[model samples]
Target: MQDNLPIRKIIHVDMDAFYASVEQMDNPELKGKPIAVGGGGARGVVSAASYEARKFGVRSALSGAQARRNCPELIFVKPRFDRYHEISKQIRAIFYDYTDLVEPLSLDEAYLDVTQNKKGNPSASLIAKEIRERIFKEVGLTASAGISINKFVAKVASDYNKPNGQKTVNPEEVLAFLEALDIRKFYGVGKVTTEKMYQLGIFTGKDLKQKSLEYLDTNFGKSGRFYYYIVRGIHTSEVRPKRTRKSLAAERTFNENLSSEIFMLEKLEHIAQEVSRRLTKSKVSGKTITLKIKYSDFTLQTRSKTLPYFISDKSIILETAKDLLFQEKLQNSVRLLGISLSNLNTEKTKKKLEEKKAVSVQLQFEF
Candidate 1:
């Protein structure tokens, strides 16, 4: 642990194959069977897969056809978002019984700051155990957890013992635990970043720590500094109870590819209206507008423009989207179109600025 930073007890709870688990729970016939939640068509993708399917190398984001090829007995079930949300609410209610400082990452996972919890239990490990037990007993579903001194470490630890298990990284073991971990195991390091890290000879956390901050910055830009600090156990992100919205978007996938620009323009107008309605409902406006285009070949491209002022009006959004659409030529027939607004007028952005400034100041006094 860094000398200047105070220790915090954070717990990350992730449900076991949440979407597929819900389907199995509702239908006894699906229990112990390989199942996937999504359409089984040429354009369909898997949202979630049961453990049985995962054993056959079937996973989320895989094409439905590929999933079936991987597991010939894979059962396809349509997703029931409303039912999932209902169960998620019940699980959150259980979390509140122990700590009000719950920050949900998604419907299936959350981080709880148990340093000062309602339970007043000194052991975060015990609290995590009790919470998981209650969730399983009440909801008839299992969850995994990772308890540590910060959000990043806790999040990574939660995956160590998955499918109804937990792992706690004590303060004394923090440095060693990180040093031995595979570079791919780091929370924010995805496939592309992992390949980049491998090319840089960074195979483990220890290898990453040996690189100078400047070297990382030169290679990974803003994210380089993030990797430098996180490897040294210096992540300071807090569990925000009400996580602010960063962006809002609306998109549509056509039943058939549209080749004409005029047809695409008409589709963009409706997407802009949906984005405008969403912004108004959230009572927030944004200065940045982005147009997303997906070709029939499944290639994606985006164009963005930032205005001097925020806007929530459909007319402005449509005009901006139209300008972007015309700015580029159609590379192939269009299969999907989307519009999004960012740089939102929210407290999260302001808080991030303040946090960045504080970190800069702290760096001068620390290593």
Candidate 2:
């Protein structure tokens, strides 16, 4: 561990099968059955699956048709975003009682810095335990937690004993715990990166630790440095309370594929209106507008334009999408149409950028 880096207590809390659990909780009939929360039609995708369904190899992002094939008895429940948001607020309220340093990753999980909590509890492990108990009692939901010196380990440890369990990696044991972990289990290392690591004979944290910083950078570019330090228990990223919104988008999948641009103009107008409304609600505008098209053959394409000035008006957005739509002929019938706005006005503050720079410099020391 680097002497200049701060040693703090961090806990990552994740809800177990959140959407599926909520469906089962609200309707007792689904409690012990295999259920999926999403449409079960041909083009439908499973947003979440109950644990019972998971035993049959059913999981999120699996197509509805494949999910049904995996578990014939699976019941499909439509997602209730409003209800989930309500429950999420209740869970966050519980977190505020313990600490103000809460960084929510999604509706299901968050990271909390409890070094100096409202309860004056010095033990992060104990605080995590209390938080989990409170969630079960007040919200009637099960949550798992991991306590460690930094966010990276805490995020990974939270998954060690899942569903309804917790793990604490003390400062002294952090090194051994990470070294034994599978490379695939590390956060931010996705499937493609895992395959690349395998090609380089990096299968475990111990194997990764054997490589030099220069060697990692040569192979993995900027991420190589991250792999070098993270394997040594030196992640210094603080738990940020307010994460910025990088982009906003809205899209729709049609019931029937449209063959001509004339058929898509109406759809683009509606999509542009939705995106405009969202931008207004967030009190932000964007200089970049993107139109995403998905063909019936499953191929996808995007066209974007960056204006000199920011815009949030529906008319301007619709005009921009129309121009992109006519930029090229239709290669195939369209199955999905989407409009997204980026280069948002709410960019990161100078303080955040400086903090990131400082973190980069701090991690440059030899292990």
Candidate 3:
């Protein structure tokens, strides 16, 4: 099977500081300045940071307070998802013109399979160039592209020359490139995993390739096999055109912690309602309801239960979340509450149920 595998032309495109860039593009006053797109409160987190802010060691998911400490001049702007979604659609349209096999990881990045493209472009690198140019010309934002034989290498290469650049790694250079890559830079290798890999004497791809599959499996479980193949530039995962939504969730943090159970329950009710609203809007329902609690001390706990039937109603979600919440004793003052629904009903299943209900209603009218 390995010998029969055909080389594919894959490109990964990533928008540079997408939200911040969009904000700057619309608001001329924000140009050439450090800005963060998110709430700038004590408990708020940065969603995206301008390149200028990044130089100050600011980054997405970093605490707003810390981002402020890094760059005092940093401007904070609220995220406009509607505008971002519109931009994303424009970018995706460009991708579809090149290849229908476009897999969006998020609003800011996507992978494209241009092995057999709509434009009949032989060179994936050229396709990537055109896409980037079109994005800038049409969308008024710059994107970086990485072209390679596979998605993993392409994703890593795209980051090599960022903001407004592109990189292509030929098949012959794949091994050499992977060998020099820092394990920390490998996709899916988070900070915790990187630290674990370092402790196990795997700091770079070279070090990772030195280990046996058995050794890796023993150390890292199933993901060990993934690392084993990826280091050899042997990733076989295709660029899936459709990625399923596995869950829906909503959460909120309070300005002040609440020690009373009644206060916590009230907050949980609100979170549940939000989650249900999202689920309804998405036309999804789930059997599993999870309750997440974050204490004032920053400790977190989650409790979940799976119901026999799928439900997206707010009352049911609220009740289930309340049950999950009460099942666990409060260890500390609650600072945040969250609810998520999983074990989702597929779109086909939802549609079938809707059709069945329609049929039942028609039968009642005939009587």
Candidate 4:
């Protein structure tokens, strides 16, 4: 079975508590102590927590007040996104030194396909180790890595050993490793799906593999096919080198919910401007504009408009957002307002240019 599988070397690299670790690395006093990166305010949520903070049950998305309750000594440091981006670029440079087939999942993690690495090294595990060492030595941050035959197992393996460590799942070990893995740990399976799987008596990869293709499809839909193959260690998704941004967005959660429609419209204007600025900075526009609203009671709603053409103009975005905002009556007092642009034109321009070049080449040949 292993001999029939196509050979590929995939590595998933994830930084250990990225934001909090960066804080500790820069501040001498924060080392060896529990720290969190976010505002420690009434409505503030923890963005990242150091391992020390994690020991006390403080974690990302936990409210700042709750995080403090978890660890009385937890220190909150405001996030430095600019600094993090700088460090992320440095880490990517290291990845590029090894392989151009690097797919960044976020500012702190990425997938690297080193089957044909620039370093001419055949061992993916060794390349992962070298990448981690370079990141620590150059950027003063530690990264954990998972090496496997495919991205699914590689991503799962990466988290098996966290905080400055690496794990490798060789082709021969893929089946055994996946069979023993908890069903909840399967990629793309979330909380609701896990509960559903448990109700269906699917508790592990072995149990999942026992389900027929038609049975999985009937139960889980299209994702059932994903599970069907992934359980057998078959994932053919390649590491995309230039993954385009699907959307550009900006949103704000207010300190106080506003009941006034005027206030909401005013907030939407600012949000639209922010989204437009991001679209311009990214040099991409989109046809779909979505307005996300979160009410005081925490219930969320979204309204969207897909235009005939892509646009990054702030005025147009603001007008469209205003239309969406006023088109519906207020469901409740709003606490958060967000504007996002999607269905981006990142590849459209490239495709158009390629067509123009093709026409030019054809004309030259005719002459």
State in Å the error of residue 191, model 2.
Answer: 0.7
Ranking of predictions according to TM-score: 4, 3, 2, 1
Q: How do the residues 1-367 of candidate 2 rate in per-residue lDDT, one tens digit apiece?
A: 7778888999999999999999999999999999999879888889999999999999998989999999999999999999999999999999999989999999999999999999999999999999999999999999999999999999999999998999999999999998999999999899999999999999999999999999999999999999999999999899999999888999988878999999999999999999999999998899899999999998999999999988999999999999999999889999899999998877574457588889888899646
2 versus 3: better TM-score goes to: 3
lDDT of 4 at 63: 84
List ranges where model 4 is wrong by over 4 Å.
Answer: 1-5, 348-367
CA RMSD for every model?
A: 6.2, 6.6, 4.7, 3.0
Whole-model Cα lDDT of every candidate shown, in order: 0.94, 0.94, 0.91, 0.92
Over the full model, what C-alpha lDDT does candidate 4 score relative to the true structure?
A: 0.92
* Tens-place lDDT digits, model 3, residues 1-367: 1446679999999999999999999999999999999978998889999999999999998989999999999999999999999999999999999889999999989999999999998999999999999999999999999999889999999999997999999988888899999998898899999999989889999999999999999999999999999888898889999887889999998877889878787788788889988998898899999888889898989999999999999999998888887786799998888899998987756778899999999999995
Pairs of residues at least 3 apart in sequence or in different chains that clash in candidate 2 = none
TM-score of each: 0.88, 0.92, 0.92, 0.93
Indicate which candidate wins on TM-score.
4
Once model 2 is optimally superposed onto the true structure by TM-score, how far is the C-alpha of residue 36 displaced, in angstroms? 0.8
